[model samples]
Target: MRINILQHTPNEGPGSLLEWAQANGHQTFVYHPYHFGYLPTAEETDMLFILGGPMNPNTDLPWIKKERQLIQELLDKDAPMLGVCYGAQQIAKTLGCQISEAPAKEVGWAPVYRKSKIVPGLPEKLLVLHWHEDMFEIPKHADLLFSSNDVRNQGFIMNHRIVGLQFHLEPQADNVREMVVNDFPYIENSVLNQSAADILKTPVPEENKKTMFKILNYITGD
Candidate 1:
Protein backbone atom coordinates (compact mmCIF):
# COMPACT_ATOMS: atom_id res chain seq x y z
CA MET A 1 0.00 0.00 0.00
CA ARG A 2 1.07 3.55 -0.70
CA ILE A 3 0.18 6.23 1.82
CA ASN A 4 0.45 9.96 1.39
CA ILE A 5 0.78 11.78 4.68
CA LEU A 6 -0.13 15.43 4.93
CA GLN A 7 2.16 16.51 7.72
CA HIS A 8 0.45 19.65 9.00
CA THR A 9 3.40 20.95 11.01
CA PRO A 10 7.00 20.09 11.68
CA ASN A 11 6.41 18.72 15.13
CA GLU A 12 3.25 16.66 14.57
CA GLY A 13 4.35 14.69 11.57
CA PRO A 14 3.21 11.10 11.16
CA GLY A 15 4.46 9.10 14.15
CA SER A 16 3.34 5.51 14.52
CA LEU A 17 1.86 5.71 11.06
CA LEU A 18 5.28 6.13 9.49
CA GLU A 19 6.83 3.35 11.55
CA TRP A 20 4.05 0.91 10.76
CA ALA A 21 4.02 1.78 7.10
CA GLN A 22 7.71 1.01 6.79
CA ALA A 23 7.64 -2.11 8.94
CA ASN A 24 4.75 -3.52 6.92
CA GLY A 25 6.39 -2.77 3.57
CA HIS A 26 4.01 0.02 2.72
CA GLN A 27 5.47 3.00 0.89
CA THR A 28 5.04 6.36 2.58
CA PHE A 29 5.70 9.90 1.42
CA VAL A 30 5.36 13.11 3.38
CA TYR A 31 4.42 16.51 2.02
CA HIS A 32 4.50 19.27 4.61
CA PRO A 33 2.97 22.44 3.24
CA TYR A 34 4.59 24.45 6.00
CA HIS A 35 7.98 23.03 5.16
CA PHE A 36 8.08 21.20 1.84
CA GLY A 37 5.57 22.81 -0.53
CA TYR A 38 1.94 22.83 -1.70
CA LEU A 39 -0.54 20.03 -1.07
CA PRO A 40 -0.48 17.16 -3.51
CA THR A 41 -2.96 16.42 -6.26
CA ALA A 42 -5.83 14.24 -5.18
CA GLU A 43 -4.72 11.44 -7.47
CA GLU A 44 -1.20 11.42 -6.11
CA THR A 45 -1.80 8.53 -3.73
CA ASP A 46 -4.19 5.81 -2.58
CA MET A 47 -4.33 6.59 1.13
CA LEU A 48 -4.21 9.86 3.04
CA PHE A 49 -3.22 10.41 6.66
CA ILE A 50 -3.50 13.97 7.88
CA LEU A 51 -1.54 14.68 11.03
CA GLY A 52 -2.28 17.13 13.86
CA GLY A 53 -1.48 20.87 13.98
CA PRO A 54 -2.05 23.93 16.17
CA MET A 55 -3.87 25.82 13.39
CA ASN A 56 -7.62 25.66 13.11
CA PRO A 57 -8.71 23.86 9.96
CA ASN A 58 -11.13 26.62 9.04
CA THR A 59 -8.49 29.29 8.93
CA ASP A 60 -8.40 31.42 5.79
CA LEU A 61 -4.80 30.53 5.13
CA PRO A 62 -4.54 29.47 1.50
CA TRP A 63 -2.81 26.22 2.44
CA ILE A 64 -5.52 25.35 4.92
CA LYS A 65 -8.21 25.81 2.28
CA LYS A 66 -6.23 23.71 -0.15
CA GLU A 67 -6.03 20.92 2.38
CA ARG A 68 -9.79 21.10 2.90
CA GLN A 69 -10.34 20.84 -0.81
CA LEU A 70 -8.05 17.85 -1.11
CA ILE A 71 -9.84 16.13 1.74
CA GLN A 72 -13.18 16.63 0.04
CA GLU A 73 -11.87 14.99 -3.07
CA LEU A 74 -10.56 12.05 -1.08
CA LEU A 75 -13.89 11.67 0.67
CA ASP A 76 -15.69 11.75 -2.66
CA LYS A 77 -13.47 9.02 -4.00
CA ASP A 78 -14.03 6.96 -0.87
CA ALA A 79 -10.28 6.81 -0.46
CA PRO A 80 -8.80 5.54 2.76
CA MET A 81 -8.12 8.58 4.96
CA LEU A 82 -7.24 9.14 8.58
CA GLY A 83 -7.38 12.55 10.21
CA VAL A 84 -5.93 13.35 13.62
CA CYS A 85 -6.71 16.41 15.71
CA TYR A 86 -6.75 19.37 13.32
CA GLY A 87 -6.96 16.82 10.54
CA ALA A 88 -10.17 15.56 12.12
CA GLN A 89 -11.49 19.10 12.12
CA GLN A 90 -10.61 19.36 8.45
CA ILE A 91 -12.65 16.24 7.76
CA ALA A 92 -15.60 17.76 9.62
CA LYS A 93 -15.47 21.12 7.88
CA THR A 94 -15.12 19.57 4.46
CA LEU A 95 -18.05 17.31 5.23
CA GLY A 96 -20.23 20.36 6.07
CA CYS A 97 -19.89 20.08 9.82
CA GLN A 98 -18.45 22.48 12.40
CA ILE A 99 -15.80 22.45 15.10
CA SER A 100 -16.14 24.53 18.25
CA GLU A 101 -14.52 24.97 21.64
CA ALA A 102 -15.05 21.76 23.54
CA PRO A 103 -16.90 22.22 26.83
CA ALA A 104 -13.54 21.57 28.46
CA LYS A 105 -10.13 21.03 26.96
CA GLU A 106 -9.04 17.39 27.02
CA VAL A 107 -5.37 17.33 27.80
CA GLY A 108 -3.55 14.14 28.77
CA TRP A 109 -4.62 10.51 28.78
CA ALA A 110 -8.34 10.41 28.01
CA PRO A 111 -10.58 7.37 27.87
CA VAL A 112 -12.06 7.27 24.34
CA TYR A 113 -15.19 5.15 24.29
CA ARG A 114 -15.62 3.39 21.01
CA LYS A 115 -19.25 3.16 19.96
CA SER A 116 -19.01 1.64 16.49
CA LYS A 117 -17.27 -1.07 14.45
CA ILE A 118 -14.49 1.20 13.33
CA VAL A 119 -11.75 0.59 15.88
CA PRO A 120 -10.21 -2.71 16.93
CA GLY A 121 -9.25 -3.47 20.57
CA LEU A 122 -11.66 -0.74 21.67
CA PRO A 123 -13.39 -1.54 24.86
CA GLU A 124 -16.53 0.20 25.96
CA LYS A 125 -13.67 2.67 26.36
CA LEU A 126 -9.90 2.77 26.35
CA LEU A 127 -7.32 5.33 27.43
CA VAL A 128 -5.75 7.27 24.54
CA LEU A 129 -3.60 10.38 24.32
CA HIS A 130 -5.62 13.55 23.86
CA TRP A 131 -4.70 17.23 23.39
CA HIS A 132 -7.13 19.56 21.72
CA GLU A 133 -9.31 22.57 22.48
CA ASP A 134 -11.68 21.88 19.59
CA MET A 135 -14.31 19.20 19.04
CA PHE A 136 -16.09 18.31 15.83
CA GLU A 137 -19.70 17.48 15.08
CA ILE A 138 -20.01 14.24 13.14
CA PRO A 139 -21.13 14.70 9.57
CA LYS A 140 -24.58 13.37 8.87
CA HIS A 141 -23.18 10.82 6.43
CA ALA A 142 -20.41 9.64 8.71
CA ASP A 143 -20.70 7.06 11.48
CA LEU A 144 -19.95 8.20 15.02
CA LEU A 145 -17.04 6.11 16.24
CA PHE A 146 -16.17 7.24 19.77
CA SER A 147 -16.35 9.91 22.48
CA SER A 148 -14.62 11.05 25.66
CA ASN A 149 -15.21 13.04 28.85
CA ASP A 150 -14.48 16.53 27.49
CA VAL A 151 -15.58 15.83 23.93
CA ARG A 152 -18.62 13.81 22.91
CA ASN A 153 -17.62 13.50 19.27
CA GLN A 154 -14.12 12.21 19.60
CA GLY A 155 -14.05 9.95 16.57
CA PHE A 156 -16.03 9.36 13.37
CA ILE A 157 -15.80 7.29 10.21
CA MET A 158 -16.91 8.26 6.71
CA ASN A 159 -17.90 5.36 4.48
CA HIS A 160 -15.71 3.02 6.50
CA ARG A 161 -12.62 4.32 4.74
CA ILE A 162 -12.25 7.80 6.16
CA VAL A 163 -11.47 7.57 9.87
CA GLY A 164 -11.06 10.55 12.17
CA LEU A 165 -9.46 10.23 15.58
CA GLN A 166 -9.14 13.38 17.66
CA PHE A 167 -6.60 11.80 19.97
CA HIS A 168 -2.90 11.20 19.34
CA LEU A 169 -1.77 7.61 18.67
CA GLU A 170 1.74 8.54 17.53
CA PRO A 171 3.26 10.23 20.55
CA GLN A 172 6.46 8.21 20.72
CA ALA A 173 9.31 9.65 22.79
CA ASP A 174 10.85 11.90 20.14
CA ASN A 175 7.50 12.98 18.75
CA VAL A 176 6.42 14.18 22.18
CA ARG A 177 9.67 16.13 22.55
CA GLU A 178 9.22 17.78 19.14
CA MET A 179 5.72 18.90 20.01
CA VAL A 180 6.91 20.33 23.32
CA VAL A 181 9.99 22.03 21.96
CA ASN A 182 8.66 23.37 18.66
CA ASP A 183 4.95 23.83 19.27
CA PHE A 184 5.02 25.00 22.85
CA PRO A 185 3.54 28.41 21.98
CA TYR A 186 0.06 26.91 21.80
CA ILE A 187 0.28 25.98 25.48
CA GLU A 188 0.52 29.61 26.59
CA ASN A 189 -0.11 30.16 30.29
CA SER A 190 -3.71 28.97 30.36
CA VAL A 191 -4.72 26.52 33.02
CA LEU A 192 -6.51 24.55 30.30
CA ASN A 193 -3.26 23.98 28.47
CA GLN A 194 -1.64 20.52 28.35
CA SER A 195 1.91 20.17 27.18
CA ALA A 196 4.41 17.46 26.33
CA ALA A 197 6.17 18.55 29.48
CA ASP A 198 3.18 17.24 31.43
CA ILE A 199 2.28 14.28 29.22
CA LEU A 200 5.83 12.93 29.26
CA LYS A 201 5.42 12.55 32.98
CA THR A 202 2.55 10.22 32.03
CA PRO A 203 2.09 8.90 28.48
CA VAL A 204 -0.47 6.81 26.72
CA PRO A 205 0.79 3.24 26.66
CA GLU A 206 2.05 2.65 23.14
CA GLU A 207 -0.25 0.74 20.80
CA ASN A 208 1.31 -2.42 19.44
CA LYS A 209 2.35 -2.20 15.80
CA LYS A 210 -0.02 -5.08 15.03
CA THR A 211 -2.98 -3.21 16.53
CA MET A 212 -2.08 -0.14 14.52
CA PHE A 213 -1.69 -2.19 11.36
CA LYS A 214 -5.10 -3.65 11.98
CA ILE A 215 -6.46 -0.11 12.25
CA LEU A 216 -5.01 0.81 8.88
CA ASN A 217 -6.24 -2.44 7.38
CA TYR A 218 -9.74 -1.65 8.60
CA ILE A 219 -9.53 1.74 6.93
CA THR A 220 -7.66 0.94 3.73
CA GLY A 221 -8.54 -2.64 3.00
CA ASP A 222 -10.91 -3.21 0.16
Candidate 2:
Protein backbone atom coordinates (compact mmCIF):
# COMPACT_ATOMS: atom_id res chain seq x y z
CA MET A 1 0.00 0.00 0.00
CA ARG A 2 1.05 3.58 -0.68
CA ILE A 3 0.06 6.09 1.99
CA ASN A 4 0.30 9.88 1.83
CA ILE A 5 0.15 11.65 5.16
CA LEU A 6 -1.13 15.22 5.35
CA GLN A 7 0.72 16.41 8.40
CA HIS A 8 -0.35 19.69 10.01
CA THR A 9 2.14 20.35 12.80
CA PRO A 10 5.76 19.60 13.39
CA ASN A 11 4.82 17.77 16.56
CA GLU A 12 1.95 15.50 15.52
CA GLY A 13 3.39 13.43 12.69
CA PRO A 14 1.95 10.13 11.47
CA GLY A 15 3.10 7.95 14.34
CA SER A 16 1.59 4.46 14.20
CA LEU A 17 0.28 4.92 10.70
CA LEU A 18 3.78 5.46 9.35
CA GLU A 19 5.01 2.54 11.43
CA TRP A 20 2.35 0.27 9.95
CA ALA A 21 3.14 1.44 6.47
CA GLN A 22 6.83 0.69 6.93
CA ALA A 23 6.27 -2.68 8.60
CA ASN A 24 3.81 -3.79 5.93
CA GLY A 25 6.16 -2.90 3.04
CA HIS A 26 4.22 0.19 2.06
CA GLN A 27 5.58 3.49 0.75
CA THR A 28 5.00 6.73 2.64
CA PHE A 29 5.06 10.46 1.93
CA VAL A 30 4.28 13.42 4.18
CA TYR A 31 2.92 16.91 3.45
CA HIS A 32 3.53 19.59 6.05
CA PRO A 33 1.21 22.42 5.04
CA TYR A 34 2.23 24.43 8.07
CA HIS A 35 5.49 25.11 6.24
CA PHE A 36 4.69 24.04 2.64
CA GLY A 37 1.67 26.20 1.83
CA TYR A 38 -1.26 24.83 -0.28
CA LEU A 39 -0.71 21.43 -1.93
CA PRO A 40 -0.94 20.69 -5.62
CA THR A 41 -3.03 17.51 -6.23
CA ALA A 42 -4.81 15.06 -3.98
CA GLU A 43 -4.49 12.46 -6.74
CA GLU A 44 -0.83 11.98 -5.89
CA THR A 45 -1.55 9.51 -3.12
CA ASP A 46 -3.08 6.04 -3.33
CA MET A 47 -4.35 6.21 0.23
CA LEU A 48 -4.60 9.42 2.21
CA PHE A 49 -3.83 9.47 5.95
CA ILE A 50 -4.57 12.98 7.16
CA LEU A 51 -2.92 13.62 10.52
CA GLY A 52 -3.90 15.82 13.46
CA GLY A 53 -3.17 19.55 13.92
CA PRO A 54 -3.93 22.46 16.23
CA MET A 55 -5.52 24.64 13.57
CA ASN A 56 -9.29 24.72 13.45
CA PRO A 57 -10.83 24.10 10.06
CA ASN A 58 -13.12 27.14 10.24
CA THR A 59 -10.25 29.57 10.39
CA ASP A 60 -10.31 32.13 7.57
CA LEU A 61 -6.91 31.01 6.34
CA PRO A 62 -6.76 30.53 2.57
CA TRP A 63 -4.91 27.24 2.95
CA ILE A 64 -7.72 25.84 5.03
CA LYS A 65 -10.25 26.69 2.33
CA LYS A 66 -7.99 25.32 -0.37
CA GLU A 67 -7.45 22.11 1.56
CA ARG A 68 -11.21 21.81 1.93
CA GLN A 69 -11.59 21.86 -1.83
CA LEU A 70 -8.81 19.33 -2.22
CA ILE A 71 -10.47 17.03 0.32
CA GLN A 72 -13.77 17.33 -1.54
CA GLU A 73 -12.00 16.30 -4.71
CA LEU A 74 -10.37 13.36 -2.96
CA LEU A 75 -13.72 12.22 -1.59
CA ASP A 76 -15.10 12.44 -5.10
CA LYS A 77 -12.49 9.91 -6.18
CA ASP A 78 -13.93 7.51 -3.54
CA ALA A 79 -10.50 6.21 -2.62
CA PRO A 80 -9.39 4.93 0.77
CA MET A 81 -8.83 7.90 3.09
CA LEU A 82 -8.43 8.41 6.84
CA GLY A 83 -8.67 11.78 8.56
CA VAL A 84 -7.65 12.48 12.15
CA CYS A 85 -8.39 15.49 14.41
CA TYR A 86 -8.20 18.61 12.20
CA GLY A 87 -8.13 16.28 9.25
CA ALA A 88 -11.47 14.84 10.36
CA GLN A 89 -12.84 18.35 10.73
CA GLN A 90 -11.78 19.10 7.17
CA ILE A 91 -13.50 15.94 6.05
CA ALA A 92 -16.68 16.98 7.82
CA LYS A 93 -16.50 20.41 6.23
CA THR A 94 -16.06 18.83 2.80
CA LEU A 95 -19.18 16.76 3.44
CA GLY A 96 -21.19 19.87 4.36
CA CYS A 97 -21.27 19.35 8.09
CA GLN A 98 -20.65 21.58 11.09
CA ILE A 99 -17.11 21.92 12.54
CA SER A 100 -17.35 23.95 15.65
CA GLU A 101 -16.79 23.85 19.40
CA ALA A 102 -17.01 20.43 20.99
CA PRO A 103 -18.74 20.16 24.36
CA ALA A 104 -15.24 20.43 25.85
CA LYS A 105 -11.67 19.77 24.91
CA GLU A 106 -10.81 16.07 24.96
CA VAL A 107 -7.22 15.87 26.08
CA GLY A 108 -5.13 12.97 27.36
CA TRP A 109 -5.78 9.31 26.66
CA ALA A 110 -9.48 8.68 26.13
CA PRO A 111 -11.56 5.59 25.47
CA VAL A 112 -13.59 5.18 22.26
CA TYR A 113 -16.07 2.36 21.76
CA ARG A 114 -16.58 0.95 18.30
CA LYS A 115 -20.05 1.07 16.74
CA SER A 116 -19.82 0.54 12.94
CA LYS A 117 -19.53 -2.48 10.67
CA ILE A 118 -16.46 -1.04 8.93
CA VAL A 119 -14.23 -1.84 11.87
CA PRO A 120 -12.25 -5.07 11.22
CA GLY A 121 -11.53 -7.44 14.12
CA LEU A 122 -12.74 -4.75 16.44
CA PRO A 123 -13.01 -4.67 20.23
CA GLU A 124 -15.69 -3.06 22.37
CA LYS A 125 -13.65 0.00 23.33
CA LEU A 126 -10.04 1.07 22.96
CA LEU A 127 -7.79 3.65 24.55
CA VAL A 128 -6.79 6.23 21.94
CA LEU A 129 -4.69 9.37 22.12
CA HIS A 130 -6.61 12.66 21.90
CA TRP A 131 -5.81 16.38 21.88
CA HIS A 132 -8.39 18.62 20.28
CA GLU A 133 -10.76 21.42 21.22
CA ASP A 134 -12.79 21.31 18.00
CA MET A 135 -15.18 18.64 16.82
CA PHE A 136 -17.39 17.85 13.83
CA GLU A 137 -21.01 16.86 13.57
CA ILE A 138 -21.79 13.45 12.12
CA PRO A 139 -22.32 13.91 8.40
CA LYS A 140 -25.85 13.10 7.31
CA HIS A 141 -24.67 10.00 5.47
CA ALA A 142 -22.00 8.88 7.95
CA ASP A 143 -22.42 6.10 10.49
CA LEU A 144 -21.41 6.62 14.11
CA LEU A 145 -18.10 4.94 14.88
CA PHE A 146 -17.06 5.97 18.40
CA SER A 147 -17.71 8.53 21.12
CA SER A 148 -17.01 9.68 24.68
CA ASN A 149 -18.76 11.85 27.28
CA ASP A 150 -17.45 15.14 25.90
CA VAL A 151 -17.91 14.39 22.21
CA ARG A 152 -20.54 12.35 20.42
CA ASN A 153 -19.07 12.51 16.95
CA GLN A 154 -15.69 11.02 17.72
CA GLY A 155 -15.53 9.27 14.38
CA PHE A 156 -17.55 8.86 11.18
CA ILE A 157 -17.40 7.05 7.88
CA MET A 158 -18.71 9.05 4.94
CA ASN A 159 -18.50 6.35 2.29
CA HIS A 160 -17.18 2.81 2.10
CA ARG A 161 -13.66 4.11 1.36
CA ILE A 162 -13.39 7.15 3.61
CA VAL A 163 -12.93 7.22 7.40
CA GLY A 164 -12.57 10.13 9.82
CA LEU A 165 -11.51 9.87 13.44
CA GLN A 166 -11.42 12.69 15.99
CA PHE A 167 -9.32 10.58 18.31
CA HIS A 168 -5.62 9.75 17.82
CA LEU A 169 -5.33 6.04 17.43
CA GLU A 170 -2.18 6.63 15.44
CA PRO A 171 -0.06 7.58 18.45
CA GLN A 172 1.19 5.28 21.19
CA ALA A 173 2.88 5.75 24.57
CA ASP A 174 6.45 6.68 23.59
CA ASN A 175 5.30 9.09 20.88
CA VAL A 176 2.85 10.71 23.28
CA ARG A 177 5.67 11.16 25.74
CA GLU A 178 7.82 12.72 23.04
CA MET A 179 5.04 15.15 22.16
CA VAL A 180 4.68 16.12 25.81
CA VAL A 181 8.36 16.84 26.11
CA ASN A 182 8.95 18.41 22.72
CA ASP A 183 5.62 20.08 22.00
CA PHE A 184 4.68 21.27 25.44
CA PRO A 185 4.76 24.92 24.38
CA TYR A 186 1.95 24.42 21.89
CA ILE A 187 -0.59 22.85 24.23
CA GLU A 188 -3.13 25.06 25.94
CA ASN A 189 -3.11 24.04 29.58
CA SER A 190 -6.40 25.81 30.15
CA VAL A 191 -8.15 23.89 27.37
CA LEU A 192 -6.21 20.65 27.58
CA ASN A 193 -7.88 19.16 30.65
CA GLN A 194 -5.15 16.64 31.39
CA SER A 195 -1.46 16.91 32.02
CA ALA A 196 1.08 15.51 29.57
CA ALA A 197 2.27 12.87 32.01
CA ASP A 198 -1.26 11.81 32.72
CA ILE A 199 -2.02 11.53 29.00
CA LEU A 200 1.08 9.43 28.37
CA LYS A 201 0.27 7.33 31.42
CA THR A 202 -2.75 5.82 29.63
CA PRO A 203 -2.66 2.24 28.44
CA VAL A 204 -1.68 1.57 24.84
CA PRO A 205 0.01 -1.59 23.71
CA GLU A 206 2.99 -1.76 21.38
CA GLU A 207 1.12 -4.30 19.28
CA ASN A 208 -2.07 -2.25 19.05
CA LYS A 209 -1.71 -2.08 15.30
CA LYS A 210 -4.79 -4.00 14.15
CA THR A 211 -7.49 -1.42 14.94
CA MET A 212 -6.19 1.39 12.72
CA PHE A 213 -4.72 -1.08 10.27
CA LYS A 214 -8.08 -2.86 10.16
CA ILE A 215 -9.73 0.35 9.01
CA LEU A 216 -6.99 0.80 6.43
CA ASN A 217 -7.22 -2.82 5.30
CA TYR A 218 -10.99 -2.71 4.97
CA ILE A 219 -10.66 0.28 2.69
CA THR A 220 -7.77 -1.13 0.67
CA GLY A 221 -8.59 -4.83 0.76
CA ASP A 222 -7.33 -7.32 -1.80
Note the Cα lDDT for every prediction shown: 0.77, 0.78
Candidate 1: where are CA atoms >4 Å away? 185-197, 208-211
* TM-scores vs. true structure, each candidate: 0.88, 0.90
Which candidate leads the pack in TM-score? 2
Model 2, residue 124: C-alpha shift (Å): 0.8
Off by over 4 Å in 2: 38-40, 185-193
Q: Residue 49 of model 1: what lDDT?
A: 90
RMSD to the hidden true structure, all candidates: 2.3, 2.1
Candidate 1 per-residue lDDT, tens place, 1-222, comes to 778888877778787888778876888888888665577788887888988887897678888888888998887877888889998889889988888887776666667777786566555656677768887889888888888866788888877688887888766777777777776665554334556577666654655334456677788662
Score residue 11 of candidate 2 by CA lDDT. Answer: 74
